[model samples]
Target: MADNAPAPPPLYDNTPTISEKEDPSALPPELAGPCSDQAQVTEEEGVASDIADKEELPLPPDPVETVTVTVMESQLLQKELPAQENPVAVEAEEPKLGEETELKQKQKLGQALQSLKEESNNVSDLTESDQKALLELKQLIEEALNEFSFSSPPEKEKNLAGTLAVEVSIWGIPLLKDDRSDVILLKFLRARDFKVKDAFTMFKNTSHWRKSFGIDLLIDEDLGDDLEKVVFMHEHDKEGHPVCYNVYGEFQNKELYEKTFGDDEKRAKFLRWRVQFLEKSIRKLDFSPGGVNTIFQVSDLKNSPGLGKHELRQATKQSLQVLQDNYPEFVAKQVFINVPWWYLAFYSVISPFLTQRTRSKFVFASPARSAETLFKYIPPERVPVQYGGLSVDPCDCNPEFTISDPATDMTIKPGTKQIVEIIIYEKCIIVWELRVVGWEVTCGAEFVPSTEGGYTVIINKAKKMTPADEPVVHGSFAVSELGKLLLTVDNPTLKKKKLLYRFKVKPLGD
Candidate 1:
């Protein structure tokens, strides 16, 4: 470490874990995330499953493949045949509920959302009514704090050796007297329609649950290391909310499924790991009234297991119950990618029953539309490569550029050619990283001089690249003369392809 360099943020010693830029690894902020996510596509919504290394499923099966969720689980799990018979999910139009179930589902869904407020960023801009509710809730919490009604967090010795704290806090903000406390309270209020008594009760329960669950100590516990890829906090979305990706498809593997849900003990451990990851991720939020106090949740369901896994289904129910009861409105939006056709049908039916604001927070994308749907809210470079983007996990590695190196993507029409040009005015070496997702095209590069009659130099000869080639192309060229670099892509196939590239000019040797 450099003598004058800022030390890595303290490892949550005296303070509660908190940071808008928290490192993804368990280590301090100086070190970042895991090498690779070990994630794969989820194809179960009605699309075909990866029958390729199909091992006999360890758990027994039920008659039908059903994807069902109570109001508490990731909304995407609500897709009610869930079979892949129609395969219309690949079409542009989404499915509405079955005619028979539409009206009935609507009323039930309405009841589910009847009390919750619409999703809003304007917690600071409260109405007179909202203000009154906020004040009432604060008083309730203050009184509880005064009386020490909430139990103290358990397992204090596990925390960094420090003095005990008298004040109770969630996500590091004190229950009273802190501006950010209002934001935390508002989440509970909005989750329960600003009903003070219900919000207060919910708050008490959360505090009690945290102590009983040993959340403070869980942060320091080493759950299954393999679970890291199942859910992880990575880069932020365009709006600055940290992005957490849930790849439940990992559970499809027999060994992993057994390890996570094989017995009651393993299931208990899995639940702890799930909650611990959420706590770690939540601590990274900025809870100030005006800060981004929420996260963007992306759950990839391509190969996610069906309901037949009774143990998993039961475990999921428990986890969702805990989240719905305690976590409240920390999720800004829940996006389910690679959704099967049935999920669309069910979501479309219930959407009308949800408040427009609440409905907006739930997004569903079919397999074909998954990558593009994610791109709408998260930049392609910030997206993981497994989902058809330029950003790689720490394992594949990005040597020439970091996330700060801006990159843009474009689509190439089938059977056409595209040329990209970059003008240079000084002596420098231009280095670039480029990738064509699922590439099967011919590409060439060259430089044209600015001076009249100056000769052009060919950088890379036009060569045919295939889907079997490396996912990204890294290149550089030295130019002592004023010139422009031209990179070309010729697509000979019938399908459109996405191209991403970025460059930076480096002066001659340091």
Candidate 2:
């Protein structure tokens, strides 16, 4: 010991040295180092005093000095001691009743902060294009608010666009990128003339309609030859937007159409056909740069005889109303070519039902000037020759025998049976229209299984037919099993009769 160092205190003054080793099991798990030492000293005081008296140690020189010496030695020993091996276990023990609520609060706060950090990370990970789009969208929203008082969105809807963008991005919806969020929102706003409430309503309705209508499924639907001939989508226009042609003149056979679709079931089919046609055209548009969002329509009225009839006009009006209500801002331009003088009267009757925005898209052209006007929007190389341009017509030009005509046609003598074999691999519909030319004959039709190696009748029916019968049969069947669909028709009559018929096979819901 150094000469200047203070004299050491007596070790046995009824105070024993706190054991450096403590029974860890006796102390609470949370107590460590100094706390455990203190507990050990207090608990074993009697044992230490007994040992000291037995040993007969001398008394301390001063009680205060003894206490000071003991405290200093304990602290120094604690500093020199190694760390405990199970500090985590001690910390993980259930907290005291007084600290339980505070511990729980801290844990909850940590969790909340972690969640906030994750959300911030997600927002920061947006691509450059997405970031640009969001900025543009915000700018547009602000512009709408400043320029049009009614266009300003309420607080509830202010974040709606942002929410929708995030959802679409997370879900990976096709054709709906985060970058196009502004374009979609602008469509609703424009449709409602910049009224936020109305725009939101339109947006909601469209979302519901998309779900109910199954537009995504419709994109894959295959339209039959009959519907395809009437409504066809061709090459792109000058602006790179797809062009659709509706040959209204070909629908001159009003009586035939009425007889073919007289029942409510067939009428429903007609409505679906119209909607699917529009959906198909919509699916063809590309949303990338230099691509247009709207379609160009050419309604050919050349040689239309019954378009002026009241029934035809009424049907046209209803069809237009449905299109306008369900699909807004879809048609960029609608050009009517070879418009007859009588057609104007029918147009006048239906034009009043159209919105000003819709009517502004109409462009009427006479037969002589149709090509000149169409050339402005469409290149001469892309227009069909029938419209006085260079491109060849992709469709059959025959008035009676259109693309819907059957693949095979034949004349069957009396007492002869003609078997028609159709091969299909999915749910489909088969339609046939037959007319007896010379005289009445007994016509028998049956559907027989072709794969079983033995004839098993699926449908067997025979009926007497006359020229006035005008028999047209339409039926649908599932083709789960891969096989041939056999249709056997028998003509059992003494006199020779000519059977002029047309049959079509098409996919269901097409």
Candidate 3:
């Protein structure tokens, strides 16, 4: 049966056949492992084996390196920090070198050592680290002192050629440097060191300190419940006026003084000389309310709170009043009488309109009495009425109205009545009683002299007046109608020929 189809491959089913799997243990070790060799094993594998062995092994009773860490007792790293030192101890520790003797020095040294011991008592509270650092610093300082001793002073001073020399403290601090040209040498002096006694000694010994600089001093005067200090400086001048400069604050270099003195050409030389020769210092000032006007320069006046404004206002008012009282009439008229002097000076020339208004009135009352009286007689209605070709001279009517010899020649135009103002130039005496007369009266004052030419009459008059005397005593009265009017003159000669007069006959209010 075709060998029964070879028994279908021995019933090898025509289906898919299962292959037998090989056990890894049954395989070669090299083939089963991950492509590794026992002789060339990696550290990772050795570590893994070691770990596994360690896991299998039991832990000892105690670890080999089970060491206990104990913190050593240190002065530092403590909870509470050491108390800081009080600086008062330091002041007492040092012996100040001042006006004292050897015994005083020893006493001061003992006090200093006691202060140091008291200060050291607090050192017990400090950390050992801090104490150690302080000790190291002190040792270093001592070493440095031993290396450079204080006893060895140099023969020539170091850094002294250009140093600043000073006799007093500046701004409350002692002056540094020691050069003669230092500005501090020219500043305000302190009484603590540069006492009057010292000053006299310096003045006597030092040629540099001459009379070029004004001496400033304060005198202690005991007043009621208070002491008053008066400060002053005297400037000695042989040729010029000896002026006393006020010592209020710091002494200003005469460089600024040039502005108040000499003309421009001489100012520069004078200022340079002053700056070189004149020496000064800061000074205290004593002042009063009235002295405000005396202030010449004010550059250093403080601007804060403006204390100067009040004083300035009072000073200005007083100055303006004085100016108004003493000025000449012409000059006073030019200046405006304002409340503030500065404003007046500022606005006087600028406001042309106001000036024009003030100057327009011709009736301005003159300060002189003579000039005032002249204006009164010049009013209208006192004009002369003379006809054309009338040459009736008052001088010609001698016996009744004795006119002045060397008579004044007056020109009157036809139908025009102009005021004639005459100024007295000389003094002339004229008889009063005998040289005066009245015009002729007809028909009981009804038929008086007519303007056409009835009567040429004269009264009291004078020819001239003295220099100090002013008499406005002449004018003519005219009648429009022919009627007589009464005339009266205290001085008959004055009415007849007055020395100075003004005549006007126009309608009033013209």
Candidate 4:
């Protein structure tokens, strides 16, 4: 075998050996057989080949450009200097009187912000955007309180926040109650879009106005019987905000009003009555739950006898100015129902006096759509039946009566009068419907109050009716004094005029 191997090849022989030919199992166990080692090396090589094949994929493209940014030595030195400031100096300065006060104020403001944030979290009606705006408004209010001084020596006496604390009061009435300051400040801030100085100015002016205008007195003052009838607030809207009805129609007797409240004393009283109406509405909101701070107004103009006179317009302007300037965003919405073309023109003229935000709240609706539109914000049950709703509280006292008689042609001679009387034991509504047979005669109607001794004209002005006009003439008056409600019709023409009329009276139930 040695001779054959010697003859086979040099050291680097290319011939196949017996180790490569034999199976690994056929080799001896004890010896480090070349067959087993060769087999193991071959297996590993196969695995390495598979891995190499798998990893032979295309590589990604290189970046388009390479940029290196470096801070200047001076900038780096500036940053390092601040970081190495002596902590002792900072601590020593923080205890100074002014700085300490400022820190306390900041801490207080932080607490207020946190409180408002937590309060906002509990409110279910606010949208995400509203909540964010509210938070910003709260911050602005805190900033205003901290930067500016709202307290005077006198005002500090009434401060709910204490004598040493910052005073937050409007007209000497503390606005910074523990439970409601956040909300109160928010209203002012929101009105001015969080402009601190502007809101502060507005709030201060409002406080002065409230004091001079006797807003506190107005709250307790009785509006008297006459004004109570003119403005009604019996129901609430769908949002649980109170609804105020201003019967512009009932204010038709300009001449009578001029006569009744002509003097300065009476005029002042009248103005106070108007102011009291608003104050009463606000008081309702103040006492209401869930922070209701708005009112829904409805101005009914269906039977308004004439276009508002100059004096009436002036009075309205003054009243609206008071509400707009002082109350700010109190009226959430205002619907003008049965608005005639002339009234629309009047509104257009006066609209310039209104702020854009206030004008945006007004809605004019026709009779056909009045109930439908009102129902959107006011539930059907809350709305009165006269406006085409389901409420029966003050049942439609507008009962129709026919005065037509088949026996006689129901004609009234010239200079003749027809008087009908119905006794009302208590406060009630008197509605009437009248029609003239022909277009020739002018018909006039008036309401009179009867005493046991004599009768007096309650409605001094006689409303004129023509054949072309609506056959119905409806009105309501409160009969506070127990007496007969007398309805009178006069034919002022020379010729005999065929007349037809009907009237209904119903007690005003609470």
Per-residue lDDT of model 4, residues 440-501, tens digit only: 33334344444566556465355566656553345556555555545455555444444433
Name the top lDDT candidate: 1
What TM-score would each prediction reach against the true structure?
Answer: 0.71, 0.41, 0.14, 0.46
Candidate structures ordered by TM-score, highest first: 1, 4, 2, 3
Superposed Cα deviation of residue 107, candidate 1 (Å): 32
Reference-based lDDT, each prediction: 0.61, 0.42, 0.21, 0.45
Model 1 segments more than 4 A misplaced: 1-124, 152-165, 451-456
> For this target, which candidate reaches the highest TM-score against the unseen true structure?
1
lDDT of 1 at 98: 44
Give me the runs in candidate 2 sitting further than 4 Å from their true place: 1-177, 254-256, 259-261, 305-318, 342-359, 393-510
Candidate 3 lDDT over 1-510, as tens digits, reads 000000000000111112422222221111000001111110100111112112222222221111111112212112222222111111122443632563475586456334322111133554665445434433443342343321123412334563322232221223232221122221111111223233223222222222222112111221121101111222211111111221111112233322322254443332222222112211121111111101111011001111122332232233233222211111000100001112122223333533322232111111111121211212111111110111133453223122111112121111122122111111211111111112110101111243576763443232322323211223333333333332221221111112121111222122
Worst 10 residues of 3 by lDDT: 1-10
Error of 1 at 143 (Å): 2.7
lDDT for residue 212 in candidate 4, whole number 0-100: 80
Instruction: Compute the lDDT for candidate 3.
Output: 0.21
**Whole-model lDDT for model 4 versus the true structure?**
0.45
lDDT for position 162 in model 4: 35
